[model samples]
Target: MTTSADPREAARTRLSAHREAVLALSHSLHAEPELAFEEHKSAKKIADLMEGAGFAVARGVCDLPTAFTATHGSGDLVIGITAEYDALPGIGHACGHNVNGAAAVAAALALAPVADDLGITVKLLGTPAEEYGGGKVYMLERGAFDDVTAAMMVHAAPVDGLGFTSHAISSWQVAYTGVTAHAAAMPHKGVNAADAMMIAQVAIGAYRQQMIPGGIVHGVVTCGGEAPNVIPGRVTADYDCRAETAEDLAALKARIRACFEAGALATGAELELADVGRDYADLRQDAEFGEAYRRSAEALGRSFDLVPSGMRGGSTDMGNISHVMPTIHPSIGYDCGETIMHNPEFTAYGTTPGADKAVLDGGLAMAWTAIELATAEATRTRLLTAHAERGGRAAGAAAAR
Candidate 1:
């Protein structure tokens, strides 16, 4: 850390210099949306920017074609800032990943000039498929985060929020198979897979009354039937289960599976469940990191009003990363005039002036937080010690194996 009046002020100035580039990146991503695990163009655009910024770039990271890592400076304290650019299937940037990715880029660019002086390495991770594929979870397993001391990213929402946690989740692809027959001629001769799905949905609805507090189960029937005159031979659906913790998520999944099994038993349909993606863990926010971020954001004129009671947060793969290291996932506000996330109206606001401001503010705040962490002896020591411990554990596990 340099002996300067304020590293944060320096970070803000650097971010201001890169303001146009960052906002341009955000708008470009918004114009072209890509889905999970399939973000080739989005990944390329971001990687290109990182390369242009003089970072050592590595594409196709962790066996994920859409994943990449860009590094600047060589220092003991490595700070990772994740950039998520994947869009929803139809809503396209409704969740403001364009803003998220741009903010990460802004932070990385701002820190690049001062990284060496601060004795910190900046790692900008292009994490894809956060919406459906749990890219971070996959990267975590594949050791993309092995050398990262701490990680953070900002999310875009209707209003600014901090210290809010999300549910752990598991998603599945479900199917039921049965014989098909003509409805009018031999309806009694065939088992109805569609009816099986209906039964399962009803059972799930009824089970909700007995479900544990904070548990959620929701799904969509992608394929129910082809024609009304013929008995449906197969039915397929996608479902998501969420709970307050990993253990609770497992228990909730068991109960939901039972309901599906009961539907199969009663309808004489063959049932199958394929796990769609990795199980996301509940977020564990680091107190020091959260406080540092709160101060940084507050300095930028962002207010922290108490979130309304019972206002729940959605699940995120970032939660998995938080469990392994010190991390913060805060929300930056943008005016959308009563529009909530995942809505088309929300998408409209993603590239607006307010959203652009969010990009700069979030990026600068995160970079400022990084500056604080790097300069503070106690926090730096704690993070460095944790990184060493993680390395030791990995080495021990590998040697035992």
Candidate 2:
């Protein structure tokens, strides 16, 4: 339903009006990088800014201290914009979460003044622990997205992309326990735990030839042994498995589990393969939502599919949201010469001029897309139908439960 005057133009004007503040937020987040579940200061920065912008901010939503929801308007048509602020372990802002967070803030601020006109609630969800923890997954389980009509967020990347798929991934903490004895004198009497790990690695390597086309397995042995002269009684390793989709990931994990079990069976060592975090489902960007975003971004002179990187995207928690509702997770690009993401080199470019432009462009583009979702009759009807259908499904599921 279009208002008397279109709100998209007003939203753009509002975004341009607050350009300085938005870039400052991005620089601040880059300067003070926080790790997963420990993004107190980072979360405070965004929440405070949103509160000042007339959003009703709720801190510590879903029992997660760093998670929050900042919202405006009371319309049933809810627009959710996710913000991630967690930095990598050693490389601060290497994944450009600073850009991601600030862009989301920009979108929220731009749309806030016009939320009522559009008959939509602009919700900025402060999601933390994207690097290591599945914060979005936790929020989903706890009902943070129960009323969301559609979700939108743009990831920071070296090249602009749309409709790209991210891998479904799972992390594991593997351990092996065995009897220790003198390595030189009574090697046969000792059940070697390191040998168990070695056998598992060998099995995995052997299985690669027959592994699924899109399956990926990678890990590191954290502890192999105490000393070479003594038989290892314990061994620990961290591992990850990725596939094209959630179903494929499940199948891949099953095969990988068998590989791990073979090590325990052959070496007579007890094995423990525990999950480190929630499994991330593969990204399934809504095509209609993505097209709207593409049009908005193109209006800002941003080009799509500019880079020719043939590789699939890495994992992200937002993929889980896409599985449930109409969602758009576009990659907002900036110029980073030869420095790939997650590297220390990439962090230095996060607050650069190019990245700043990305913050503004991406933010305004998302705002415009939201306007399109609200005013365009066909698109609005499609999304509204999805929202209603999703509600019915939820009701049915609740009844069964």
> In order, what lDDT does every prediction score?
0.92, 0.93
lDDT of 2 by residue, 133-194 (tens): 79999999899998999999998999898988889999999999999999999999999999
Q: Flag regions of model 2 displaced more than 4 Å.
A: 307-311
lDDT of each residue in 281-380, candidate 1, tens digit only: 9987788998999898999899869564224589999999998999999889989998899998899999999999999999998998998899999999
TM-score of 2: 0.96
- Cα deviation of 317 in candidate 2 (Å)? 1.2
Q: Which consecutive 10 residues in model 2 have the weakest lDDT in total?
A: 304-313
Position 39, candidate 1: lDDT: 94
TM-scores for candidates 1 onward, in order: 0.97, 0.96
Q: For candidate 1, what's the RMSD?
A: 1.5
Instruction: Work out how many backbone clashes candidate 2 has.
Output: 0
Best model per lDDT? 2
Count of residue pairs whose backbone atoms collide, per candidate: 0, 0
- Please give the range of 10 consecutive residues that has the lowest summed lDDT in model 1: 303-312
